[model samples]
Target: MRIRYLLLDVDGVMTDGTLYFDENGREIKGFSIYDGHGIRLLQKARIGVGIISGRSSTVVAWRAKELGIEDVHQGSRDKEAAYEMIKAKHRLQDEAVAFIGDDLIDLTLLRRVGFSIAVASAVDAVKQEVDWVTKKKGGEGAVREVIDFILSAQASHTKTPFS
Candidate 1:
């Protein structure tokens, strides 16, 4: 199936599932430049990107804003619900959506979406269930690997002006 939307899980998929706390009890996350540029390339190819994270973080909101991704759904414990809402809002079917996740919380959506991707560092169960397991670990160019696969599958990478 042709993919039109790419849904992501932030903690494990985007940030290596590591949580840091400052002295003031603020949350901190390290984002990958490779992932950011991959997202940009996906957007340039007209593929919509959305984030559905179980935890709420201002940093995530800020990152999404910086990436120009409007479909940000944070603190969504029930990611399937968020997935449904995203599908409805975008008027897309399951076959049109691809999901990348790293934990069991993402199982339902992963099994339901057309393309299911799991990071190399994902739980064993997650890796077993996914259509593809990224060679790169989360927050370490895993997202970029997935984007490259998607763009290549869609034959959009060759058409993109940027190298």
Candidate 2:
């Protein structure tokens, strides 16, 4: 099956895996423009994108909203539940989904998806389990790199809105 949906883990895959807390006890995160543009390309190619994060942050929510990602599942202690909900919501099968992760919290879902990916700086266990390990580390063009690979594999890169 082709990759119809791409699921992401927030902390490591989209960010540098660093947690920042302000003096006001609020969390902040940095997202990459390259990843954002990649997501737009994927969407233009008629692929869906979503987020499933173990930790909840408004920054993530804002970013997802900005990127037009509707299937946002944050603060999920049971990621399987989120995964199931996404599949059910979209009437998707395991073969139609792809997940990118860098930690153990994302392992079960990653293994279950059709295409599993790990960022270069991911834990050894995660890297070992994923179908592909990116050359770029998380938050440093890894997501974009993965997008290009998947689209290229499916021979759908030309379908994307951009050349």
Candidate 3:
């Protein structure tokens, strides 16, 4: 399958599944710079990026904007619906999509996409279903690893300018 779009799940897939709350009762999420650059790299390659997460966080929106990810669907319990929206939005087929996730909730979308991936620390069930499992944990360069894989898969055909 030729992956043209990369769909991501936050929380366990992007971060280490850790949630923090400050004294002000404000929620905080941590994102890795490596993942940020990975998003940028994908953007440079003209590959589409989308996020379908079950939780809705202001930080997630801000981070997506920072990384130039335009297709973000938050608070989506039924992720397959979100995936369909992206597929229609991009006019892409399931065989051209890659989804990376880490939990049971992500399994539905994972199974439907062409290339499903999981981070090294992902749940056993999720790892079992994925076509590829990264060596790094979430928010610790897992997304970057996937980006590299996609780019490498198309390397011979397209010379993407990666610095």
Candidate 4:
């Protein structure tokens, strides 16, 4: 099946599942440039991307904006509802969508999408249930690996051969 849209979780799937804070108690996150570029590739390929994280963060919003992704829905306690809304908004079927999740909160949508992914360091239960597992761990370019896979599968990649 062809996946035209992708939904992702933030904490464990995008980051290393670590929450950082300074003396001032400001939350900080580190993202992979490889992942950011891969997201751009997906957009260039005309594949829609969205975020459905349980936690809300300004960092995520800023990153999504930087990547030109418009379908972000953070702090979703009921991810299924968010999934349904996004699916309905795009008038897409289950077989055309993919989801990446790394925890129990992600199981429902993971089971619902046509393709499901788990990062390498994800919980064992999550890894076991996903359709694909990344060799790279989250916050370390795992999202990039998944994007490369999808782009290759869709024959949408246009990188030059480094011969």
C-alpha lDDT of all candidate models, in order: 0.91, 0.90, 0.88, 0.87
TM-scores of all models? Answer: 0.94, 0.93, 0.94, 0.93
Lowest summed-lDDT stretch of 10 residues in model 1?
A: 154-163
Q: Compared with the true structure, what per-residue lDDT tens digits does model 1 show for residues 26-133?
A: 999999999999999999999999999999999999999999999999989899888999999999989888899999999999999988999999999999998889
Off by over 4 Å in 3: 157-163
Task: Please list the residue runs of candidate 1 whose C-alpha ends up more than 4 Å from where it truly belongs after superposition.
Answer: 156-163
Q: Give the TM-score of candidate 4.
A: 0.93
Q: Which rank order by lDDT, best down to worst? A: 1, 2, 3, 4
Model 4, range 100-126, lDDT digits (tens) per residue? 889999999988888889999889999
**RMSD, every candidate, angstroms:** 3.7, 3.5, 3.3, 4.5
Number of residue pairs clashing in candidate 1, backbone atoms closer than 3 angstroms, sequence gap of 3 or more or interchain: 0
**What C-alpha lDDT, on a 0 to 100 scale, does residue 135 get in candidate 4?**
96
lDDT per residue (tens digit) for residues 48-98 in model 2: 999999999999999999999999999998999999999999898998898
**lDDT score, candidate 4:** 0.87
Clashes of each: 0, 0, 0, 0
